[model samples]
Target chain A: MDRFERQHILSGFGIESQQKLQNAKVLCIGAGGLGCPILLYLAAAGVGKIGIMDGDVISLSNLNRQVLFGENDLGKPKASVAADYLRNKYSDLEIVEIPEFITTANALEIMSDFDLIIDGTDNFSTRYLVNDGCFLLKKPLVFGAIYEHEGQILVFNSAKAGGTNYRDLYPNPPAATEIPNCNETGVLGVLPGMIGVMMATEVIKVLTGYAESLENKILFFNSLNYQTYTIDFNSNPELKKLIPDTFEAFRAKDYSLSCETIPSVDWDFALSQQNSDSIIVDIREASEMPKLEREEVLYLPMSKLLKESKSLLAAGEVYLFCQSGIRSLKAVTELQKVLPGKSIYSIKGGIAAFLSKQEESNTYGN
Target chain B: METKEQKISVRAFGMIAEKIGSAQIQLIGISTIDELRESLFDQFPDLKNMKFSIAINKQLASGNAPIPADSEIALLPPFSGG
Candidate 1:
């Protein structure tokens, strides 16, 4: 018996549609709650090539809804774990694992390989990045996001001509702390799974033409009362101008929550550039530990650094780092106002990212 | 002709509904998206900082378009959860 025998026997979704599922390539971003089911069904339906891109690791809390992994898979990279699950189930399935988060530098190159992109990420920055990247590449995108008991799904860039993108729906991102995510608000465990299945259905519809796709329409679903609303929208010409004009400009654009744009570098770049021309400053408070013991690394905390920003005028370039990348990015935004002419860069993942990378390398090297 | 303040039936969803303390409500004399926003903010001051889109009769409004009398309005905020 054929593997897709059930789908092949269907009247509308015959072998032709089954083959479309086998021949099409799809890339899914974020292997959390939504990504779990999206990946499972896509692979089970015989999607030829699947790409899983996520930078998060599985924690104990995620076992409730991220159904792909078990307790044994804790502390494992989501992309690799999900890819491995699909590969083991379907031997012929082609799976590509990207163990890094999507960024401006890598968005275009990573998205160019697939026919469709599914965004299940939990942040506004990555959602906008994927939306803009799909528009730039002219690829169909299935976007799904959730909050508590409600979820929203939209199929963008698949309308054959001019259609709505995410920006058309929300021209501007919400302020950093204005809107809360599931982390703060808390979500029902089954909410994302239900929404994720709908997102996957949309992907199948778009690829195989089994049904009318959700193009130009955004569906809002509330599982509590089983209420659903489908709203029609069109691409705004004025909003299209907000996207970068070219690939180079897109790469240079800042997708962070803050309006202030700052260049960010990895730990390696910050470490290598510790010279007389460029100085490295630890922006974390004096109480923070696991501190860098290098003589060249300065220990000026962010609180006092703002007041005495001019004290480091002699250095041609300034590199800032903190416990995590959040504070460092904010510090760069503040310091830029004080020292307008100086070059300031925030270390991408701060000390935590560097420590994790070192641990991974050690595990692999052994 | 006598002037009557027509009411618009507004339905809020997700965070917007949570902030307003109800999923459904009625607003009087709201003829445009901006006016509806101002009235909502006047009532629920917490909504001033929240981000949401206004849709009239199930169609997303890109600008401050005029709202017809007795239109079915909805307030939708972007959901960031996966």
Candidate 2:
């Protein structure tokens, strides 16, 4: 009795389907909540080659949903940690650990190697990046995203022709400020597990030719209500024009600029500029947690900061940060307009980046 | 021409539900996707700034497609989480 013997014995799935699973190469982006279950089932079902790509490290907050890592593995890179655990569990699994996020510069080069790509990332920038990259490469992309108790799953650009991609559903990302406060509004732990398994089911169907995969369709599921809706979508030629048609155009496009106008600096730069002459304004709302206790940092929500941009003219350098950096960039764009010659920078990845750095330093004693 | 009142049932999902304050709503005098959009924006002004798509009778609705009488319409906003 082998690990996939049960699946192999199913009516339509046999040794042939098992062979297909074993021969397939899939790249799963983001080893977070959804990535954990997607990777588990895909490996358990005998996927011969899998690529785990995530630039984030394990944190205490992630333990509840990221099932692959425990407290003992805290502060370790997600891609490497997930790869090591899967390798230990399965002897023949070929795992590629990409301990980095996929950017326009690397998306095409990295994604071109896989038969399919699964997007389990949490942010819109990466979501659009993965979808556009797969569209350019002509690879099947299994898309899954969660919001509180609800999750959305879809298979885009499959081997089947005339299917719609993510862009068709929402041609442009919602405004940065309009996006829900995800960091503050938490997700139900089991939501991703349910949706991830569904996404994995699509991957298997798409790869093995077992059944009808979710090509040209989008699924919406709410765990609280246990209600599911599968809607059919068609390619929008106008929306298709919004995506880059050629690889060069794809690489040249600034995907992040859709949310961020100015390129942000890392913790080092943000820290270096934190002096009496500079102001470190926290742009998160008053209720948001892990509030910075530093004396140099000022607490000003985005709403107040944008309205009060003129008052910051006296500050030497303005460094803004929000929970995850999106709002701060919006703030910088607004501030730059008011203070043309002034240096207003956004701390990339915001307080999350700062805290992750603290976690890394605490773990390594650097 | 005799005037007939058009009432369409709308189902909101994801963020749209939170914004609209209900999972489902009865929109009156809306006979097309464009009309439904105008009515929703008129009723919930915040929705005008928000991004969402409509699905009429389970098919993705685009370009002022007619809302069939008694059609089940869905308001879906893109979910960015995972």
Candidate 3:
């Protein structure tokens, strides 16, 4: 009875729904940043059964936001350590640890056992693998991601009412280099924690049948501005391409969407756009381009655009640039969806290419 | 002979970015994985022994790629957040 004491947070759902949560099984992918918070809250919430899977080991850097382990846990496989932490910390919760990396080869078998899966994985290759596996298994997915100061959360799987998955939003992935890692551009320590907590909140919402949860909608947040925005996305026509009847068919399909995407030209265009007064607005952080030697332009990071629409530059022919053009493309896509007919182009090579292009153009022009 | 101080960029991603001070650093050092790590740890003490991977020019590299002057080197940690 003491275990059920002030845990009245779930009491509002009535015991039946809470029992649903307790009986539910969730398989978490990745034991890193997002996984830590989701696991912590789910275990604390007394989810009857939890499954943890990851191939990576604990690193010294993970201690900051992972918040799951101390110095002693370093160098150990994340799945084992994370499961051990949850099992010991919340002795009441039942936990299973799959200490293997979830690859395309084993994704189906691994995800089939769980009622729901959380995509805590960091890279696109794994995200696609997780998405395809969940789609095949027809299990609901709780998704979350963090950038420097921004984050995203969505839930999907046709089984759950109002649940829409990752593919509904991004039909394809960006080229690996198009998007830099958090290492390339530092992320606020609390950004992923905030997003991870939001994801955990979504899991509770789905399990307890909170009708107003973020279903079929992508929630975006800017930590710097403390602003949040939600875009209603549905079963897109594009997602239909992901449906595969057999494993081989699935394997053949270009699940590596980022690799297959059209090579972008942000840098070439940004340089030209800026040199010719084409309204060069950097969709990345201003700090990112501290030494940026652009002539005439504007600077509005993606985080800024997420909350405040492009109403300011809702003018003619705006050129958006980011680190690798992916963010700008994403920003432009989101913006164009909302403010249709606005002219916007993504700078392909980001600043690097643009600088080179500028130099080339100047060399010839001179 | 003067050892040219190659200004290579080391990009830190995910949790690894947080440990290595700012996300991107144009580190000035003799281009080599060992020297790069040495210089990085020399500046950011907390990152010592922090397990992470390095990528050069967007391609994953062994820890021994010669860091040429003004090359792009990225530091990656296991990112669990999708």
Candidate 4:
């Protein structure tokens, strides 16, 4: 009776699968909710080498979902803490602690050594970076994400033939403002456990060739009702246009930039611009609600601005805004192409934040 | 002759589900992914500002594809949170 006796005696698993697991090298990014379970399972299963890459320190808030840490583990770097915990429990497991954020400068070097890459990150920029890097490095990517009560799991770049990548599903990154991570939306404590276990299962399936790979399909699970659905995806030719052709282009690309939101000026700064030579351009469509009544505001939709950007060349300083700051960020990106060195800013939170502040000020004044 | 309207069941996931206020909904008179998106945006304006993808009959679909009547549709947003 050995450590792997339970899994070894299972119907489809045996010493062969155990050996494969022992020889596999896996890297999990973002040692948070999903990472906790993934690292636990992979290390416990005797993965030859495991890498935990994360730059975040454990906080009290992570306890609900990130099960790897206890109260004493707080304030420690996630990668180091996760590595230390697993190393202590399983001395046979070799864990590499990468206690830094994955950026273009180091993503390729860090990820290239692993045979499989697990994406447990929380931000779109890192998600896209991991996806592209895995594609370039040709490593299998086990992807998992959670929001509120729901979770998504997918395996990308696994099969040699007819496999769909993340870009196939999301041709472009969503506006930063559009993405609401767990920090904002919050997550149920057990949701990541469910999804992370599934991700680990997929990793084993991929490594041992035991089950069919979730290469071209995505699984969506809802904990509220415990309902699960699988969605199939095709490799779109058009999506290739969105991916960079060369490593140089991929490295130079800015994943953080999105048309939906950009650097925005505060309400006070926008107010100051009212008396200055600065121009405020509203980029919302005509049908959109909550119009600003300021006399200095220019009512120009994004469609019109795209066609007639030359109209803005004469302005010394320009401010762009939309209903929720997403379109204005996009407008800033678009306008910068033509306006070059001209001063342009996207009003943060757009009219939504601005109007909320206005109502608050009125209530306080009374 | 007036064509019969198509009705599809839509499942919204992640933040898009929060914005729609329901995990499931019955969408009427929608024949294409593009049309369904327009209807969703019309009903939930905030959805237009968020990033999400549409899956018809459990298959990821481009906006121009024709969706079968009574097909399963899902609005999926990116979930990067671990």
Docking class of 4: medium
Every candidate's CA RMSD: 6.7, 5.1, 23.4, 11.9
Query: DockQ scores for all the models shown?
Result: 0.77, 0.74, 0.10, 0.62
lDDT of 2 by residue, A213-317 (tens): 888888899999899998998888789887899999999987663545475787798788766688889987764556777988888787687688767778898
Return the TM-score for candidate 3, rounded to 2 decimals: 0.57
- Over A1-366, each residue of candidate 3 has an lDDT whose tens digit, in order, gives 546445555446656666787898899998777888899988887788899997666666677778787789776778999998888887777899987666566688778788989988776656777777777777888888877776767788835534355655555554453455553456655777888889888888877776567777656566877866555545755565766657776656544324333333445444555444357777765435323555566777777775666454545667776643456656666676666676767665455445555556888994
TM-score of each: 0.80, 0.85, 0.57, 0.76
> Chain A of candidate 1: what's the TM-score?
0.76
Q: In candidate 3 chain B, what residue range of length 10 has the lowest lDDT sum?
A: B73-82
Q: Which ranges of candidate 4 are over 4 A from the true structure?
A: A160-163, A259-261, A264-366
Candidate ranking (DockQ, best to worst): 1, 2, 4, 3
User: Which candidate, 2 or 4, would have the higher DockQ against the true structure?
Assistant: 2
Q: Indicate the residue-level lDDT of A260 in model 4.
A: 38
Residue pairs in collision within model 4:
A259-A330, A260-A326
lDDT of 3 at B59: 50
